[model samples]
Target chain A: MRRVLVIEDDPKDMAITRNAVLRAGLFPDCVATGEEALSYLLRNDCAYILVEPCVKGLNLPLILSLANKRDRKAAIVVITKDSSLTSERKLREMGILYYMVKPADDMELSMVLQNGKAD
Target chain B: MEKPISILLVDDEADFRAIISDHLEEKGYQVFSVGSGQEAISAAQEQDFDVALLDVKMPGMDGVNLLQMLKEIDPSVEVIMLTGHATIETAVQSIKLGALDYLSKPVRLSELEVTIARALEVRHLRRQAFQLRERLRQKEAFPEIIGKSRKILAIQQQIEQVAQTDATVLIEGESGSGKELVAKAIHRRSKRGDGPFIVLNCGALQESLLENELFGHEKGAFTGASTEKRGLVEVADGGTLFVDEVAEMSLACQTRFLRILEAGDYRRLGSTKDLKVDLRIIAATNKKLAERAKQGQFREDLFYRLNVFRIVVPPLRERKEDIPILIGHFLANSEVGPKPPPPVSPEALESLMDYSWPGNVREVANVVERTLIVSQGLPIRPQHLNLTSREVPLVTCGEKDLLPLEQVERDHIQKVLAAVSGNKRRAARILGISLRNLYRKLEHYGLANSEPLKTAL
Candidate 1:
């Protein structure tokens, strides 16, 4: 599998997501800010792009839009601290595969990665 | 890079207009305030505005009447109706008249801003969608293949043989040799020519994202999915999906792609429902697939499935005979309006022909465009040519290599296109080329501005 790209500003959240990927037997390349994520995506392919809702010096919407633009096929899973209806709707329109609230368990994350679709 | 969005405010109430205009201008909008519907109509006729705020009950002309006139002038300008009386009938009527949103009077500034923002967004999307549809419609006419060399003739013959069949074809070519153009030609000549011809760059996105694009997700399918979205497979139901750079797909994505090819059955990212599609897939790659398959870099089964029918797009170096003809085609096909391209000196032509086109026809196109820009309206001189430093032109020293026959009839059409910002109809009229011909060249050179990257997917 192509490695996942984790875009989380919060070190704790980034650690949790990175650990979850490792436990699932997948390697991931983590970026701390949206700028790093954008540069990374331009040159590297991401199996799944896990993005944070907000990051320092980076507009969340523009990042997601650029991500969506650069890679239309990648499943974009948003890791958001605030999943208000408005933000959810906005990010959804940005064409993300899903948005999970912060502090999600490793098991749930792994399950979503594998066999989340009932069909 | 983004120009400020301009707004036209029309309200009969002077005090209301003054207060709202002041606040909006403070927010950094280029606000143009007028007191009545008549003034709004005249102002709209005078200048292009992004959005128009019209009061429902205006003195001289009602908002509804003015709305029709404004739309007649420019249907793209977004209009928001403001009313003091809360009548459901008027609201419905305003909407029917193509009002973006209806706002009650005594409108809070914050709410007004939100409405205005939404209106602007709608305008932007509508413009994007319109441009997309126009390009697709224009893309229907395929360009004349500009090569008469044996390799190109063979490829053209192969295209003729396979165009009518609904088969999976893998086009192999070097980058920039017009692999995508060949795909479009195949689609144009196919039975599905009338249907949507969608394209995806397989190498551009990762495996997981590619899956979402091919198979859509449902509402609440993931955290951010608020509504059910359709995928490219569904969109390409009756047409063709041209997946470019198929060799760039990861092994996992290749497996998924093969499954789709095998069964035409797939599920969206999160949905439980299985979607079956009926369409032909045309995939292209510059890589030698068989070699890659042997090296275990590509799956043998997927390669076999994709290689059922193959078209090798010969590189430009193999067809040096076509260079002059190709130059003529490019010169005639310049995006420059009515003005014909300046004549090319024989020496300049020799330099262009001698330079190895590492970037293939795409590079040739760029050189032609850049040379045209540098040459201005003068005959193309040897110095006007911009080639890589490595390819020293075989220039005849000391002689001003001039063409005995000055084919300077070309008026250098760039100015008309610049005047119109590449609007094809006006360009066609000035250049005397058919609208379809202009579109074909523009599409070939990738000059059309608002190409629908997400749409027709």
Candidate 2:
């Protein structure tokens, strides 16, 4: 079973994503802030990572550093409130595998996760 | 048909003055009797006395001199001159010196009350007229546009120039930058000022819905089409049609919109009747349309047609000089109360200027409103702003940085876990990894039995 991690500060948002993953028949871990996220990854062998746009203290730079390390193939998905091509392109350039705008229904999340497996 | 009025009596002849004052007071009138002209002046100055009766034959300052002085003290005080001996010249002089009326021999109480009542009516009318004039002056000082910044002035000038022409205008700026305000300004100053001005946000609706919204739908056009409806374009005929976020329109919608622009004609949904609309088009967008056009996400021809007259509204950060003016504009127009919060502190203003307002003018307005509501009457401080200061940390990774992914992940997770007091679930969430993955990794890193890991779970 491929493991998934959700990095988000909002508790309600975290629960929603967790339930959505569970509905998709997957168990995922959740954290409150960016600092804790980096530490979790250091001791984990995660198959996939989900990040929100407002993850404090953990930004694109830190994510890039983690990606550049040995297992650079791990897929990362970024969630943002804004749905713009420019933002998507920027995330792509930063080595994020996928980008999804929030208030994303369960179907959209499931689709992204399925796409991740294929990739 | 008349009511008795109150009068203040002033005279050195206490017997005569008291007798007449009692006569008037008995006629349902309130009379305040004073001994001398000096006493009368002091009494009138303290209270709002409607009328004053002065004896024309007083010892020191007779009626005429006292009348002139009393008129200066209280312009509204009606003075009735009471003279036991009357002469035409003295009566004329008393009347000229501002006495309301002169009486001969013993003063008639009825006549005195009538004169005082009329004077009070005149005073009331004068006050009402003065109040009306002041209100009109206030309205003219503050006209519609709120900001006093030079940027706003420049934008106003641009609107004046563009409004006169029939050219299509494209307004580009970040979200909440008051693009609609600029559009309204153009329509207000345009030749079609009397005609209607309609707005449609392209990104807000689906392609089919947007089409129906822009072009009227025929009865039975679709499932929910219960009645015939005129679209925004037909309603906006002989006026301006402002399309907000035009870049968000679908490619197909763009083709049809472009054709309508080129031909100045459109057809209703489920109908073949061609409708001609004499309307001006004004479009706004936050996205870079040119870049989107190059990427084939937006139509190039449509972009050109809309970009004939371009107005780029600078973001809030670019126009930091306008912040104070904008704040003042909001403050003056604020309907808070008779008294508002103390002026925004310089430190707070400087912090606001330094912030990179991704939300633009609308965001600033929201922040100002929030600050006013939260701070009550206190001065707005930096902490009240609710803005996050962004700071970027500099880090260098070398060739030796080719550390194992697992090791890197472990080091980062350990640091974060330590920072968060060994909370595994929180640590995993922050790393964007699942709890199961975190546990598996803990086992892989040979830290599965660690006390911190146990405590965290």
Candidate 3:
């Protein structure tokens, strides 16, 4: 079982991701802030980190830096509502393996997780 | 016959007039009585009184003269000759002069009140009915934005959710994909609907002009600034400011705009005082802002700031199901005469679906409008469509003897496989054939040494 960490501020979005992960038969531990997520990764083991791009006080750059420090070999997936080619290229260069647009269907999310696990 | 029911009492008898006023006031009616004929004329000038009672025995202006003057003031003012005499011819002459009724000595208030009430009710109902008809007429005259496609419905849902809040929204889509329409919808649905909805196109002007356009300038801020002016931001105070093509805004302007977003205040171009405005910012862009930020063209901090909430409008090609509906809508409203040519043929629609719409919704609208103009009263045929062939055309290899279907298929498969490089798993996937089938086909075609096949694991 792979441990997945989801950092999101919106309760509704967090719930949707949590339910979708469960529906995909995967366990996802959720946090509302980036600080909480970093602490969780430091104390426990996580195979993947899913971060919302515009969370309060936990933007993409900050989250990427924290993930780099953990050295847990966890794959990072940046979720954003604005899925431009620029964001994709930047995230790819930052060592984040995948990027998904918000409101992504269950099938797309499942594919990303499965692909990340394989990688 | 019923004692000329309504009467306007005018007298110089202080005690007698008070008694008449009291009696008239008791009954449910309107009474405009004055102490003198001069007062009577002034009161009648103000509004049309149903009846007027004048004293025939006054000093300067007698009842006869007052009655004539009142008639001159308003022909509609009913005059009731009031006198202390029983002269028959005087009464007959008064009646001849258009006096409604004659009252002898004291007048009864109950009779006058009932008659006036009945007359006023008729007038009130007529006005009420007229207003109701006018309101109904207005409602039917205007057409509303219509459609219930999932894409449109989703946009409507987002409008409803974000409209009530003051959060900044970033609308992303290809040009002509209804970005402005969505912005308008948000403004209309928001609490700021009654407030001004100001739109500033960031692409239309240079950075200096745009800065001055957004933040007002004092007199002589620059060579062109001969007079003081309030910018769109200040003008849209207490409402919404929609920045269209926001990605085109210069970095200098973006920096200032970011501060306004954070502090909710900004200083005029040449003014020292910072003007605080309460407004909702709704910015739109066709460019990928995130990608621009990555390229160092757009500020990363500003991108994150404006991207508090994002509504991505799907391009027209993604939602082909809506094309026909949009066509019908645009056609119905088209200036083209009644009875537009026949509906678009199935073949034309199929061709349209195959052609990628690079310009998105705006392009689709332009094509529809152009088709209507060119094919007036004729069925819209594929030939009439101005579709550009952008897709790769399949090559024809023969004059009479065409290349074999298997050979063409094999060649196409080999091309795609080489492009992705010969990972059998990926190559087989791209060809939409089983790996075993692909391998067998390669052997049967005697092309097993194809570069893609060599790298096959």
**Interface CA RMSD, all predictions:** 10.5, 15.1, 21.6
Predicted model with the maximum lDDT? 1
Task: Give residue B231's error in model 3 in angstroms.
Answer: 0.8
In model 3, which regions exceed 4 Å deviation?
Answer: A1-119, B1-147, B337-341, B390-457
Tens-place lDDT digits, model 1, residues B262-314: 99987887877777888889999989999999999999999999898999988
lDDT (Cα, tens digit) per residue for candidate 3, span B1-457: 3332345678888888777767766663355567887787777777766667677777667788788888888766656677787488888878788776676765555554544455445545755797899986674331233355788778778878998888899999998788888887788778987876777777754566577668867766655444565666776787888898899999999988988899988988888888898889999999999999999899999999899989999888777777777767777766553574468888777777777788776666667767777777687878877875645345666677677799898777777677777677787898888999988988987767767532343
RMSD in Å for all candidates: 19.7, 21.6, 27.2
- If scored against the real structure, what TM-score would every candidate get? 0.46, 0.46, 0.46
Point out the worst 10-residue segment of candidate 1 chain B by lDDT: B404-413
The digit string of per-residue lDDT tens for model 2 on B52-148 reads 8788887777778888888888776777788888999989998888876787766565676676667667656766787787876565333444455
Which model, 2 or 3, shows the larger lDDT? 2
lDDT of 2 at B21: 72
Order of the predicted models by lDDT, top scorer first: 1, 2, 3
